[model samples]
Target: MIAIYPGSFDPITLGHIDIIERGAKLFDRVIVAVLSNPSKKPLFTVDKRIEQITECTQHIANVKVDSFVGLTVEYAKLHHAGVLLRGLRVLSDFEKELQMAHTNKTLNHDIETVFLATTKEYSFLSSSIVKEIAQFGGTIDHLVSENVAQDMYSKYQNQ
Candidate 1:
């Protein structure tokens, strides 16, 4: 079955990669869909985020990277995906994701939201934290891939 993993992915972190890698193994195909949200100012543009995700997940044969600008459920339906994959790193994440899952259920009963618990190593990892660290000239090599780390480092270098 095709699964859609949607997120802002301002700068794809190891935690996000963990979910994508695991999701790829469970589903026939996993599309890493980046949300083109305009409200929040993201460190990376949607196109750039997609490119970064593509570069990071190149090792996974069944993973595809894309972007969308509408309801995630609609995007999933358009892509003919039967599942909406998400990752939970903490209780706060669970609370927020659970509400989204229920809201998504109301929007489309055909699509199922599946949540994966993040590994212990990435329990505290987040894109915001990654960006913060990078913004302060701190090393983010451990949070993201080497390529992504370079991108982050370069992005923050100018500021």
Candidate 2:
């Protein structure tokens, strides 16, 4: 029942929302886990990303958004989640996800990773791309939730 949807979610885009909505429909509970990594230059902080995801998914009864700062498998274990959910927008995501799935399986044999194909409409929408558009004063209203778009615009302006 409880499935963990883990991702950096630097800026939760429409693609992420699509995956969460689709995954939530199948699981009793869906945890939208925001991953934290200090190495990469992220546009938004973990707290901000969590707030965006929480705002976007608040209407979904079974979805909960939270942030994690360690191994995904460890987070899943602590959260009592037995399933790991992923979104595959294209074939390019396969190799990395496969490796991660195997590693997670090695860490927790009982936990499984389920990959869901993103809807065609959202297949081209990535958080990075949305951030680029937002940073350049381009409208990303359709690429993310209304709240996310507004937050991105405000954040970019303040920068």
- For residues 63-110, write the lDDT of model 1, one tens digit per residue: 999999989999999999999999999999999999999999999999
Instruction: Quantify how close model 1 is to the true structure by its C-alpha RMSD in Å.
Output: 0.6
Clash pairs, model 2 backbone = none
CA lDDT scores, all candidates in order: 0.95, 0.90
Candidate 1 ranges beyond 4 A from true positions = none
- Give the Cα-based TM-score of candidate 2 against the true structure: 0.96
Which candidate leads in lDDT? 1
Query: For candidate 2, lDDT tens digit of each residue in 43-122?
Result: 88888888889989998999999888889989999989999999998888888899999998999998999999999998
User: Candidate 2: where is the Cα deviation over 4 Å?
Assistant: none
Q: Compared to the true structure, candidate 1 yields what TM-score?
A: 0.98
